[model samples]
Target: MSSVTIEARHEAWPLREAFVISRGAKTAADVVVVEAIDGAHRGRGEAVPYARYGETVEGVIETIRSAAVHISSHADLTRFLKPGAALNALDCAFWDLESKRTGIAVSARAGLPHPIAKITAFTLSLDTPSVMAEKAARVPHLSLLKLKLGGTGDDLRMQAVRQARPDAHLLVDANEAWTTETIGAFLTAAVECDIELIEQPLPAGHDDILADIPHPVPLCADESVHTADNIETLLGRYDAVNVKLDKAGGLTGAMRLVAEARRHGLKIMIGSMVATSLAAAPAMLLAPYADWIDLDGPLLLARDREHGLHIENGIIQPPDPQLWG
Candidate 1:
């Protein structure tokens, strides 16, 4: 048997601009990365420890370290860790390391098709309606734009963005920021502005109210649906789910989510936190299964690592092996 080593560390990548969402604004994406060495081959994976989920970079790093002794293979991963960013980074690193060691592409090893370049949604950070419109107007080449919402003026915000970029498709993520009183108006605005999808309009536990509301525009479960264990509860309330690798414990749990989402007849949207291309690279492989692709993290960053995934005008090229699997 060859020697193997794995370690985790924290990294912070600056964003081109502050990414303001319903929860808050972040100028830098603080992430935890797991790097594994198998003999002469090396592989890496990244995950952003989101505060909304009560995760911190330090906590995630410790989690990865505690679980390092058990990093034997990818089977029965839940036995070692829970669903969140830490397990995500570890599992992703395992896949990358495996692909490198075995001389096989991750897509092939996973029984998926060859990964390809695909279009992704450019994000418009939450701001005043006019400011958001200005942001939308600036990205005329990106045909799909996902807006950060959940404020009181979402309807106006939607209208302004639409007026500014009528040609672009739109997805709205409220990040569990909306309330029962505000959902009605927001849904109406989404319909009026041709919003393609509305994500987590209400808080996770509070989203049961969604069952009573009419969804002229389809609603997607973000915070409400993490692992497939929560999919049953969201069936009557949600039309789709946004699967982020970090939330689903990397590609392992993420594939399970795709299977469960399909079995439950729910649409899929592959999403990511604002981080470097390393975080988005592995997640991009799921683009084939998603109804929408929102892995725009690299595009939001001020700079990415060498041999990062090439993204031009919101079009994402498959990640090079030098970067990850």
Candidate 2:
């Protein structure tokens, strides 16, 4: 095997303006890009901070730099970084580099026979009821929509959007806003509005309540589950788990999570933190095995790096190598 080295670069995107949520985001998003080089071939990956995980662009860069020595030695990608943004970027870059060296697409290497467009959930950031409703109305043709909720005002926000886009398949991600006492009532309201799934209603440590409460909509674990290590704990509390490349540390852990979640009879949703197309492409390798896909990272960007994944009408096409493997 040829020795490869990984390098990290930091980039930023000034949001067209501040994007608000239960947590706050101001202008300019900080991002880290990892590039792996061996001989003349190169593969790249990008990772973005998840405020939920308390990650920043600088922190992600530091983590990647620490991993660089191991990546140069070509140590096992699967064992290096704990599940988080840094490992996710390196794991993806390694996979990309390997595919390029061998001239094989990730799907083919993973035993998938063909690549096709995947239906994706377009996310609506947390906002006021009327504004969210107006935004939902514009996406009339989307087959799936993921709504962000978690504030004091979410009830009206959800109701308004659901009222406007009644036909769109809807799911809600509270990002750990609702408490145990509120979960049942929230699910009740969600079901009344025909919402299909509710993700991460409670914060990670406080999820025991899920086992006792009856959930009308399928409940999915997001903040609560990372890597395969957390899968056993997540059972019975959640019907599904949202697997993000950043959260699992990369495709390696993601595949492990998929296999184990199937063994435990948990539905899988492949997702991404808002990054760029370079970040989303690696995760696409596992989408064929997931029940729902949320690779809209590029969609959230004011602009994306060139030649990334192409998304149209809320469907994500397979990766084009001009972007990343």
- The lDDT, on a scale of 0 to 1, for candidate 1 is 0.88
Candidate 2 is scored at a TM of: 0.94
Report the C-alpha lDDT of model 2 over 184-280, residue by residue, as the tens digit: 6777778888888889998889989899878778999998988888899988899999998788878777888888998999998999877778888
Q: Which candidate comes out best when scored by lDDT?
A: 1
Expressed as tens digits, the lDDT of each residue in 195-282 for candidate 1 is: 9999888988988888887889999998888887888999889999999888998898898898899999999998888888888988
Cα RMSDs, all models = 1.2, 1.7
Q: Candidates' lDDT values, in order? A: 0.88, 0.81
Per model, how many backbone clashes are there? 0, 1
The segments of candidate 1 whose C-alpha lies over 4 angstroms from its true place after superposition are: none
**Per-candidate TM-score against the hidden true structure:** 0.97, 0.94
Query: Whole-model lDDT, candidate 2?
Result: 0.81
